[model samples]
Target: MFKIKSEVGFDMAHYLCGYEGKCANIHGHRYRLVATLKSETLQESGQCRGMVDDFTNFKKALKEIAEDFDHKLLIEDNEEGRELAAKLEVLPNNFDIVFVPYRTTAEEMSRDVFNRLKSKGFKIYEVELFETPTNSCIYTEE
Candidate 1:
């Protein structure tokens, strides 16, 4: 199989409610997302002939995904988080909030990004999300 990978970066803040660690408090990260796509065959016609996919298009999609989270507060769509979000909305400083179906963790983010790209018709092989320069989480289908 042939595979291609693209990397995108964004900045965001999050907190794991009810956790007993420093991460339970709000914090930010310079997040990095790596997406991999795989296929057994290459295109045989058109501008993409003999290529897995256009690198430009792949990077553009990744960038769009990254932009969605850039400069935002990512949080779970729970009662507490929602309430906090509602309160924050009225603050003088404009804030961006991204409510996710799951907890705001690197592992869950990887899985969420993988599913999103897959739904866009990409043959996603894996998604890796870096919470720190040395820490990362990867998600892939078995």
Candidate 2:
């Protein structure tokens, strides 16, 4: 198998609603995401000959995902999330809120990114999202 990896970084804040840990408090992370694409054989014809896929294309797809989350607050779609949205909205040009269907955890984010890139026609093999420089969650599908 031929595999290539690309990475991008984004800054975002999130809180775990209803959790008792310190993570329940709103905090930010400079998250780094790495995406791996795999192919059984490299393209033998075309501009991308002998390549699994263009690394630039992979970075572009990742940049799209990064832009959506950069400098934004990711909130879980629930009661508290709604409340936070309301409060932030009142601040006018102060906050950018991004609502997600589930808790804003690295595990969920890895899966979400994996699906998103897959839909974009990438032969995605895995997605790894880092909550910190050393802590990360990796998602893959067989």
Candidate 3:
């Protein structure tokens, strides 16, 4: 199979509600995301001929995702998270707030990114998210 990988980095904050640990408190990470795409055959026609996929297109898609989460506070989609976001909104101009369907964990973030790119028509092989310099998570369909 032909596989290509692209990576992007972003800074964001999040808190794991209902958890009894330091992670339950808001914190930030310099997140690094790597997306891998694969195909059994390369394109034989068009400008992308002879390549599995255009690197520029893949980078663009990854950048869009990174920009959306950059400098934002990511919270779980729950009543407590909503309340927190609402309170933040009333404050003076601050960072962006993003609500995710799952806890703001590296594993869930990887899966979320994988599904998002897959929906955009990419044959995604996996998504790797680094929550810290030494810790990371990978999500893929086998």
**Of 2 and 3, the candidate ranking higher by TM-score:** 2
Give candidate 3 misplaced runs (Cα > 4 Å). Answer: none
Q: For residues 58-115, what per-residue lDDT tens digits would candidate 2 score against the true structure?
A: 8999999999999999999999889877877888677888899999999999999999
- Give the lowest summed-lDDT range of ten residues in model 2: 87-96
- Estimate the Cα RMSD of every predicted model relative to the unseen true structure: 1.0, 1.1, 1.2
lDDT of each: 0.91, 0.93, 0.92
Q: Report the C-alpha lDDT of model 1 over 20-134, residue by residue, as the tens digit.
A: 8777778999999999999999999999999888998899989999999999999889998888888888998787788998989899999999998999889899999999999
- lDDT for position 5 in model 3: 98
Residue 89 lDDT (model 1): 88
Q: Global CA lDDT of candidate 1, please? A: 0.91
Best by lDDT: 2
In model 1, where do residues sit more than 4 Å from their true spots? none
- Report the candidate with higher lDDT, 2 versus 3: 2
Q: List the residue pairs that clash in candidate 3.
A: none
Candidate 2 segments whose C-alpha is farther than 4 A from its true place: none
